[model samples]
Structure formats: structure tokens, C-alpha cells
Target: MITTVQRPTPADWDSWYTAGWPAVVTDKESESFHRTVQPYPGMTAVDLACGNGQWMRQLTAWGVFVTGYDFSTEALRQARAAGLPDGLSYAQWDIDAEPIPPALMPGSLDLVTCRHALPYLEYARVLTDVGRWLKPSGIFYALVRVADDQDNATAQSDSVLESFHRGFTEAQIDGIGIGWARRTTYRLSARNCGIVLRGYGDSDCQPCDVSS
Candidate 1:
């Protein structure tokens, strides 16, 4: 069992949402997210930590069966106001505190997208959870950045491994992408903002098994 570093309570999280963090679900992120998703008309997907349901709207527009989950009521309200497509659904959720519920079955999803959400989670726990939820061929997509990944553990802890995100290898880790996921990365053109994606098998995927 992987244990994630503890974080601010739900109240703190609620406060962040109330301050309008999920206010904008822009086109670039949306397009990047869209590229990661292999949606079909009836394909089932889960958008974890779906702030303002940006991916939900985009996926639904492509004819995917998108269901969104998040921890904040205010964000969910913003999601509702985002004009959800007819094929989309939503539920309130906190992935850190609880396991994926029955409504979100393991190995049942075709895709899972998490944009700007991982910085708030314990990286290892989040990765394993996503692996569990994905089916044999299911794809997992997330947008993580250096800016949103700060925590107090780094300020006081002496462990170098723990101080930095062990998973981040100079802003590249598990991802098999070309472009950087950090906030400061600049793009020469619109198309230059693309990803350097790698493919991993199902939960049983071994480290050397990644094909892309």
C-alpha cells in the first residue's frame, strides 16, 4: 500500500476553490487534453479532479461518455455553469481520502484525464490509483507542473529524495512527452505546445514495458 504525504484539509481545499482557481479552462490545455483522450461516441471516461469540467465539455463534444469528479463544491458549481454536454455526468469526489467507489469501477474506463490536479496529490498514490482504475488498454492523461507541486515537507525535511518530487527528472518523469509540463516552458508556436507521450500497459506494466 502506497501512502501519500498528508496535505491541507478539505477546508483549505475548499478555500482555494472559492478563490477562483478553476476559473479558466483555456483552449491550449483543452486541446492538449483532447489529444491525450482517445474518445469514441459511447466510450466511458472519468475526469478526476475535474476543475470546472473543462475536459468534460471537450470530451462530450467529441461524443465521449464523460463523468467528472472533484473535491470542491464551488468548482462543481463552476462545472455546472460550464454548459456540460448532454453525454456528460458528474459526481463529487475526493480521491485522496477514499478509494474509487463502485460508481467508478476499476478496469471499466477507457480513459482518465487529470489536468492541473496532480500537484495537489501525493504523486505515488495518485499514480497507483490511476493505474488501478485503468483497464488493460485504458489510457491515463494528466497535466502536472512544477508551480503547483509545492509542500511544507520540502521546507523542513532533510531527505533529498523526499525534498524533491522523486518522480520528476528535470521536469520529466513517467511521461513520454517532448514538451515540458512545467509552468515556465515557452512555445514557439501553437503546435509547439504539444506533449512527449509514452505508452504503458495495464496495471501489470513493467518499467521496461513502456513502448512509447
Candidate 2:
């Protein structure tokens, strides 16, 4: 029989981050992205479910206008406390909701980065919205959970972690990147079973590489 996992509230998430919970994506992941992405000044981007706004700070430092979205009050508080310079902003929203906010309009962004947060939301719906929100030449960056990973075991048990509810497949990623210009995917972990999806809108799409 299938069991239900309770979702964590904003306060719970805040406490988790405050406790210095380590993030899955570190220098290696960011290096991979920076190597692939060519960020220009005035570029508009969004960090979906941005925790503590580290990625947003990086983008802002690179002169990209960044908007961060998250529901955790404490996380946002930390981000604000960092004293964001111009070109950075934040919004609070439950990403699982049916319609995304109007601020994330269709074809308006140059990039959208989502890390370790896809499982909590309806994966397909969020993917579709990300695609629509991207400009014709925009890029989508994501680190998503897969069903085959041991991390998914929580999905079989009663857990409050979002990973328990989120998983992905190559076919689903393909379906989401229908019109992407270039697509590169890599596996990040052996034990966790996660994949990094890098989809560009202006370049020619390439074959999916699962070997990583």
C-alpha cells in the first residue's frame, strides 16, 4: 500500500535551512553551469524555490537581474539580511499551485534555475511553466530527483521531506524540453539518483547523456 508524506511548512523549511543543512549542489554544479552559461548584463533570471538566495547573489554579482521565489520566511529573511544589491528581488509563493504568478509571464526570462525543489511541486506542470516562462533564447537549469535513487525510499515510507514525493525520468525531461535549443543532462550522484537538466533555447538541442 502507498503511504502519504506530510509536506513541510515554511517554518519547518526555515528551521531546516537555519540549522545549516547542507545543499546538494555545491561548487561542482555551479561550475558546470557557469561553464555552459554566458551571462550578460541586464539578463533577467529567476531562481525557483531559491533557498537563502546564494544563486541569486551569484547572478546579481554577474550583473544579471534576478528574481527569487520561495515560501520560507526565514530563508528569505536570511537572503534579505545579506543586503542584496540592486537587480535582486524576492517573492513568496507555494509553487505547487495550479497557476504560476503573473510576474513569471510567458517568454520573459533569460534563465530559470531550480535546484532540489522539483519533487515538492507537480513536476510536469512546473516544467511546462518553466518552458513557457523562458524567452525564445532562455535556459532552464534543474537538479531533479529520480525514482531509482535510494533517496526515493522515503517516498515508500512516511516522511515529511519533499524528495519522498518527487522523482523524474529521461522521457519526462524530453517532454519538458520540446522546443529547447540545446539540452544537456547529467547525473550528479550515485547514491541519491538525481539528474541535472540544462536546456538552452537558442542553440540546437543535443542527445540526452545519462552516463554522467
What TM-score would each prediction reach against the true structure? 0.67, 0.78
For residue 169, give model 2's deviation from the true position in Å: 6.4
**Which stretches of model 2 miss by more than 4 angstroms?**
1-6, 22-25, 145-150, 161-181, 188-211
The lDDT of each candidate is: 0.57, 0.70
Clashes of each: 5, 1
Task: Highest TM-score: give the candidate number.
Answer: 2
Worst 10 residues of 2 by lDDT: 191-200
Task: Quote the lDDT for 171 in model 2.
Answer: 46
| Candidate 2 whole-model C-alpha lDDT, 0 to 1 | 0.70
